[model samples]
Target: MDFDALRRHPDLEAPGLAAADAADRLILDESASALAEVAGPPGSVVVIDDAYGALALGAMDAGARGVRVHQDPVTGERALAENAERLGLAVDERPAALPLGAGLLAGARVVLMRLPRSLDRLDEVAGLIATHASTDVRVFAGGRLKHMSLAMNDVLGRWFERVDVTHARQKSRVLVASGPRQGPASDWPRSARDDELGIEVVAHGGVFAGTGVDIGTRFLLGVLGDAVPDAATAVDLACGSGVVAAWLARERPRLVVRASDRSAAAAASAPLTAVANGVGERVEVTRADGLEHLPDASERLVVLNPPFHSDAAVHTGIATHLFAEAARVLAPGGELWCVWNSHLRYRPLLERIVGPTRQVARNPKFTVTASARRAASPLS
Candidate 1:
């Protein structure tokens, strides 16, 4: 159905909230029937994030007195707030809009979560919920049928009560869970290693290469140690679990290393990695959409492993935006170093934005490129 038709349909309004991108594919539904089957009403505190806003709105419409909606601090904060206003509900004043980690669910009675597309991060969310949710709390999670996997169900069952599947409707299915509270937070097994760059790296589940350091990152770290200039400020752009940023701080203890990601969970996990490695004082973690919050020309070095796929789709929009933003925020002569899939075309984009891009290193699967801000360029 088209967005216009969905907006005009009276039945769609029954969800108490409706969301559609330009495509209008019923992005989310939080109707009374849906919420009733998932989480019962009255005094329950309902929490929804991203596409799950419709469900939270439905619960509110179905007589839920308190509802807290979480959005990834990096991307969904604005949209979630706008969604709340659209439904005529007051936004929560607490720091409840960020990612709903274990700390955020301390008092939630019921949670209706829309599973994210990144399966790598699911364990982190499950671990958080398991740690915080009471035994009596009901956690109902749903996703498109195609995205649901046996492993996903297994992960949910490990942390929550019994897991039961609901019939698919509108191409989505729900996993209903209830049980005794099991709060052992051993979700992500840690593997520690001292890299060649004088940094001790500890990785957890969901962090890229959580099982072991990715060869691409290890290659980039080696290059960074050799090429990084003596600068006061640097940033690890897509810092997955704080490996590169923590390494930078360990190698150059006086330099301020800032780490950022679009995932609130990644940002939350980064500082812990830094603290574990004893470089917490030198590292600052921010949840951001690529350089959005950084001042123009503020950093002398920007290191990244630009992601090619957002969820399951192969897209370069994020990498393109990061290059543009990196160029904008780099000090004159500042360097942008990035590693990407060898098949992905990023060199031209880097050249167009940062000027005189060069290949620093390459492996069978990935290529590392470096570009320096032009001192006399228009961007400068």
Candidate 2:
């Protein structure tokens, strides 16, 4: 398969990573039967966490009839759609990311995936495949050796009777597993009480930071005690697990809140977090890309703890793009509350991109800043 034909979304750029990686090729090469299954009938093969269009398009190129695919990032899904149209290929795309179930896996004899970094995520996926896919299902999971670990083997072993590792090729390797064994039902969407906040934090396996609140967010929350503007509507941009959004809704009962993220798991888990905190009715969660759909200067407040990494690559553009979008959607006197690692030095950039930025609070590691949508004067 000519994997180089694939391309990442135009909006995303990571320094070391290309449009397609060697693991994608290794996966397609190692799973001949699976590729054939995808070409022969629908639901015989399913692809998960494909970074772009590589796996699905590669299957189509190999004469696959119908390939069902799920991508965790909005950019990846859009890139796949764009590539499919560019290549004139038809792919049976899932409506959302990682919607693991019988509809996606039923009668599927083969599962192809580019392994995710989170072992918890892999655990959930492996369990789902073993439980929902055909009893004869064979899973081909591949990734870079640096990203792969013995723990993945252990995780897959929990759900499959056999897990074997292939020799490394081009810095990538595949884990071949079969003999699906029935396991207990999923333990995801788990919730735990937050004693300090007097609410619950709910999370799925794939959510960012995890079930507990991270220190960066915790610090941001501490500063937000009196920071969130009094407004009719506010957004928790890139809301992971919806802790901030739920808190905002509870703090201001009248404010309608929107919690959004690029990951389907995060978006799906947000509402649960809200409901767990008794604010579900006021908090609206969505899987979206950077609040791009909101009209110009329509939002009175926005809060963000933008992710610093893109996939495994440390990329600041992700945060910068969100800042631009926040500036666009925020009303004239609106505020964009942001928290980031102190070392990233985002205040200057924030001032330039949005408007005047002032430090609200800072810890040794994180610095919280609130920038106005359009200040009286732009920062020099």
Candidate 3:
């Protein structure tokens, strides 16, 4: 696929999420070289964790047919499909949308994976490949050296018999591994009880901080109802792992809550978290970009810990975008309670986007604020 042939989905809601990056180019180039050197049987080429279409389509360009792929983020998955159609190459996008399962690697001889930031997530990916891939499968994983770590080697070492590190190129490195080994059962979706919340948290590999609560969400949970008093329905916007959703459902049995995020993994994890906490049927979980799936002025309260980064870049537009979503969804006199990094100083922006905003709580690193929508004009 020509680099020019690819594009991030025009409708992707993220502000700073890139369509493709240097590491993507590096992985494809390195994988091509590795295959050329080894001259191995090539069928069922798979790309894992590709943020967009670069790896899979790049493989397609290199004469690999039936390239199966998996992207953990829903947005990334959509982008790959949209880019594939944009290329107009007899586009049957079924391969691009394959999940992480036998169908994805029934006979995978070669795999290209973009390294994830979390060691646990990497362990999950590597372990799945070792368990499902054909014996001759060669996995080429690459990442920027700055974000890559020694722990990654150890994680891959657990599943692959041998892990070979390639020389760095453009500050990016590829890990070439073969010889899948059978190992102990994977401990995916690990669960633990949070005594403070009096509920269990079952987190999949992609969940943040594993089973432990993030400090920002923890702070936000401490003051949930205060932000939108008397509101019957509440939303956990950008609900990562659904800690807030579970907590709210348990705290207010009458509360109707929804947890929504852009990541398929996170969206899947939220329901698991609810089931672990015995609130499965009570809380609704949906994978969505902001409040696109919800109607205007339908939500009475929205609790958010808006992510500052769009992919890897530190961008405030992500938070601003979420603020705008809250402004659109919240009912008249409804409120949006948000927790964010103090340094970001989201107060003024919140006032402009969601209406009169005030600091509800503060600490050394994080600030919690509540912005009430004007009763006159929900849009305004």
Clashes found in each candidate (C-alpha, N, C closer than 3 A): 3, 2, 1
TM-score of model 3 vs. true structure = 0.93
Q: Against the unseen true structure, what C-alpha lDDT does each candidate score?
A: 0.67, 0.83, 0.82
Write down the worst ten-residue block by lDDT for model 1: 4-13
Tell how far residue 16 is off in model 2, in angstroms: 4.0
Q: After superposition, how far is residue 52 of candidate 3 from its true place, in Å?
A: 1.6
Model 3 steric clash pairs: 1-61
Error of 3 at 55 (Å): 0.5
Order by lDDT, highest first: 2, 3, 1
Give residue 195's lDDT in candidate 1 (0 to 100).
Answer: 48
Question: 1-380, model 1: which lDDT tens digit per residue?
Answer: 12322231211122324454311122224233434543444334546444424454445555565456665534455544555565555545222453465556765667767666555556666666667766576676777777778888887777776887766777777776667346666545364666455555555445666635677888887678755568887999988778888888888878889899876657776888788779899999887878788998888899989876544345566687788889988888889998888888789889988878899988788888889987864773
Q: Residue-wise lDDT of candidate 3 within 211-297, one digit each (tens)?
A: 888888888788775756677888999987889999888888888888899877788788999988888888899888788889988
For model 3, the superposed segments whose C-alpha errors exceed 4 Å read 10-18, 33-43, 376-380
Candidate 2 lDDT, 132-204, residue by residue in tens: 8888888999999999889999999999999989989999999999998876887876888888877699988
Per-candidate TM-scores read 0.81, 0.94, 0.93
